[model samples]
Target: MDDTDQIVLSVDGLQVLIDVLTADGYRVIGPTVREKAIVYDDVASVADLPRGWTDEQDGGRYRLVRRDDSALFGFAVGASSWKQFLHRPVVKLWRARRSKNSWQVVPEVPPVERLAFIGVRACELEAIKLQDQVLLEGEHPDSHYQARRDNVFVVAVNCAVAGGTCFCVSMSTGPKAESGYDLALTEISDGEEGTVFVAEAGSGRGRSLLAKLPHRPASAADRQSAKAVSERTAASMGREMRSDDLHELLHRNLDHPHWDAVAQRCLTCGNCTMVCPTCFCTTVEDASDLTGKEASRTRRWDSCFTIDFSYLHGGSVRTSGGARYRQWLTHKLATWFDQFGTSGCVGCGRCITWCPVGIDITAEVEAIRDSEAD
Candidate 1:
């Protein structure tokens, strides 16, 4: 059989797989209930997963609820994406200390952790690839990001339930994982068999790990069930965007009245950027000791919504909320194609769900198209 062939793993065997990964010195990180929400955290067993629980998300709303059965990956994504581990919110770049006659410099090197990420969604996988293009394929590739990314393993989850704000189906980035995973799983629950994972190996490492697990060759029925899960999610999506000529549409509507309308409700809190899986903007900060003997440079996540983000020689370029909002939206939906050859958004819908004022990006795009039609 081909190495990429599908297999079926019982729910109990899933724990054994986790045990094997942890035994191999991989820090397994997956979804867990935290602060009344399902967020990624350290996992050693099935108990760490959001079992028998799911989430309800909408524009500016999120709540955890009990599921009918114990399905490990029944819920859609939460505010936290895997980018937190790979890109990091804050990192020290280097340090310098004053010497007797000259300055002594010490470069800060980030420690690489052997990480195995569980429950990675399809859209998030695409986001990871986008970040690789941004941080690993650029003129000045980020050694720090590359080190962590290289040491990481991905266990992707195909969605069975689409969040109220999710639009990954529209973006062609989710509801099903196509590639970029060591192993991909589609959770299936049956009255007789209870819950089982239909798994597929995407890499040589995945096949090697599966060989060690208690998994059997998947049957035709299991494959059909897995396909049904993705179909249900695609049909149940609460939001969607029309992507036809989307880049050109946004490029032409730079001064659209809709931007001003949304800007009035926007708080510019940077929550959207914080939750977005693909937003990669960052700022560098330098700090010195009170004695001015020691100093360090640090890189921290930044957002375009901030006034200082667009600061130039004279002052902040995007001083108005409308201008900043325009810059962010245009860059994400339009100019990002020019810069990266793909849209900055993966349609995970974190931006819409976490927006303070329930601002839906798909709705905004539709409004622009409607106005142009009129």
Candidate 2:
């Protein structure tokens, strides 16, 4: 990653740069205000972005309210997640046909498109990394995942505003990105100074794009201002969690009463897993055609919160909703490091922000810790 103080575009110049990228054969997907929420969609022009739009959210609560400024990427994530693009909520796996003597099966591998994801938050980037480890690093990498991930370009944005539920600072995934992006942007603005984007190239591909743009070398003051902004955003987080000794904390607290306490409020709707950037568990299903002459297989995202997620020969290993919820929370906050060498959470706070029952993971952890301290 190269943070060489490059001033690639003024805030207004970003629109022109997007057009150039589109002409250069990149499918640009970015945030646009729709139905009162910032959503990722195909953007042909700068006007497509949610200018003068923003959002307000709390646990089990969301509203598409207005902001004082017309900042496009001023809000955090919404109900939609990056998983919708990568894993796909629903897809056909293969079509099968039966002959007189035998059944013939043809496996399907869906084609992927070249995409340039713009304004990706740091937590979403971390979730992509986690999926890469699960989908690409295994003995058999998914061909579809490989195609999409390998071909896509990333343009990460440092958060200028933290959502009411955001806690990326606690997860150490933001407000300034450290890795996993092709290009990074920090928006700079003031009533008198106007707006500019402090740009940096994170890869060779990013440098090539930077070279084509009309830009100047950034000053030391520019870098300092960017840092200051990121720092402020990080400090303003609505929640915090103690991650040190998390594994031990969860491991020792398996029988803690906090699990049952959380279960009372947890609806187990799996919204947390669905909104999570890194939860990659999925299930495959096979179904026969009406005529029984053909069959199809499908794969869709699944969550441990579901009762069937832990089904065994006899029955579900985790019989209680409380147990299932505890398993997921523990795996993400505690045991994920042992298995993957990284915490499962990137602190996007989607789990907490979107949960129908307003179950907060940070609060849950703190409760467990407080009990242990007592």
Candidate 3:
């Protein structure tokens, strides 16, 4: 963002922003300490933020650590993303009642929820955009996802520190918030500065809302400091994967032996897909009460790792664990561009951290590339 439009917010001002957003009738959700992880949930005030807390993440590992400074939003992403709130793991479509040997369909009419999400990362923002392409923009768009996606407010945060599993820099997705946000915050803390957030407005609504907060025009020095934050983070990314012609690379390696290697390590537990920010596969489930008087339809998230996900008339496709693993990684880094005009991955690296066996997506692709060279 240009220095002319930049501004600064103190800790108290940050709390005011949250209060103002709530007063504007938005359910302000943000990162907080939950279950020893920084998860997104209802954040009523700045006090609810995970100050002085950061996370240590690696393949098949995650631990919460304390930072010397009380910098809110200092940590990287946890297991949860904003997808759960927007895409929703479970949705009730409708209910029905049987009256006089006839069934009457009952329509679900729930009040639309207006949500304001804070601490959304740049790659996570891209994940949301990818979901919009799949669920909101196509000819046969998903009405349920669209309904929840509308009228939402986004407050993006630029990374001041990189996670042990992060590779967003390799994907060219972020260390900074480029777009798809209302307000973007960069927390700059030092002994001289104590702690203050440099805020940038990305939309008209953001600018209007920012003008109401207790803030001062950000100086050029502050802008430089904020730029330094992303630079340091980008330089220190924990992992990387080459993206040039990646689609073709995976496509040609269908019979690659490395698939079997990964399959041996993969438990087909679907943990990666479950924690993924952009995986949108879902299955519809219908159930009836024992009384046979009421019935309901619901949509729940499904994964390619499940055997039943590819069930056909007689049997399941991709029967072997290798085939299932290949399908997932291939679709994420290769065929997703064919389907959505963008890579299915934003390189957040949750797949590696949350995998029980520490399956790294970058290493898998590199192995395929190395095999091609050999």
Candidate 4:
């Protein structure tokens, strides 16, 4: 967060930084063009990144576009979030095997994934913090999340380009990373001077890594240029959400007509919950071999939109699409505050851009507000 340790790195130096992290036994995870979309995957070098590409995103739409400038972190968030790596979509809990007519239960060995997350956005960082609160700070902590989170290196990116659905500024989360990063970089494209990055060390590990990379001390001009990038991104935010009094607003609007309207367009495909970085709901599945000698239990991500998600002995609590949609929205904007002292929505807009029917959360909330005001 401090500028005292700020340094400058050329595009080549950025590659060196990646090599250093990889040499230090970290799986270098970053953004790359895959299937025509910039997605997070294993990066072998700097060339693997989507350098000259950005994305055009809106409700029910996402398309990759080439940028005039070859900026690596120019695009907004993709459909894939950090959740797929940290809170795995599916995990085997334990396996039961029959041995000598007695079942032997054996726990699955935890994976040793020392990940180095590169190009992490500010809202993504905040979402990670929120997950930490739920998965680590809670009474019954998730061992899988705890194990995967240990010793993970975070390299955050200061946004220079805002996507069409980005509302992190309105949510008070991004365009700039304030905390939760080992190293933060702001990529500045200079016409003749070429592209350079203003890097700052946010942790001791970051400071150590920066020391190894080839870089010069950032001048006052460098710092100002970096600050300008954040300013530009903040002003370019594509959407705005009224974060004030959302808990009480949604709390009182439980029976509002907006839910039914949204439900009409909702497919309940669970795309939003899957892309949500903070959604932690999951369900377990038990499997057995044909011989019935071996059995296993696996945990996979689940969504509130599914009727079975609220299944009880007699029937599912939320049978209608309206009820399920209300549960998803209200819990995100209302009960999340009661449960965890913070809004569940990070305003990253993944839910908006990836929805099959283009159901926008901000618009849905605004509809209720407008109706109540009328």
State every prediction's TM-score relative to the real structure: 0.98, 0.95, 0.97, 0.98
Candidate 1 differs from the real structure by a C-alpha RMSD in angstroms, to one decimal, of 1.3
**Higher-scoring candidate on TM-score, 2 or 3:** 3
Q: Provide the overall lDDT of each model, using Cα atoms, as 2-decimal numbers.
A: 0.90, 0.81, 0.92, 0.92
Q: Give the distance in Å from residue 247's predicted Cα in candidate 4 to where it truly belongs.
A: 0.3
Per-residue lDDT of candidate 1, residues 1-374 (tens digit): 25339999998888998898899999999999899998899998898888888889999999899988878788898999999999999989999999988899999888979999999999999999999999999899998899899998899989989999999888889879888999999999754688899998899999899889998888898898898999999999989997768899988988888988988999999999999998899999999999999999999999999988989998998988888888888787889999989888888989999998998899988989999999
lDDT tens digits, residue span 1-374, model 4: 56778999998999999999899999999999999887999998989999899999999999999999888888999999998999999999999999987999999977888999999999999999999999999889888888999869999999898888899988999989999999999999853558899999899989999999999899899999999999999999888999897999999999988888888999988999999988999999999999999999999999998989999998999998899999998988899999999999888999999999888899998999889899
Cα error of candidate 3 at position 346, Å = 0.3
Query: What value of lDDT does candidate 1 attain over all alpha carbons?
Result: 0.90
For all candidates, the clash counts are 0, 1, 0, 0
Stronger candidate by TM-score (2 vs 4): 4
- Candidate 3 C-alpha error for residue 238, in Å: 0.5
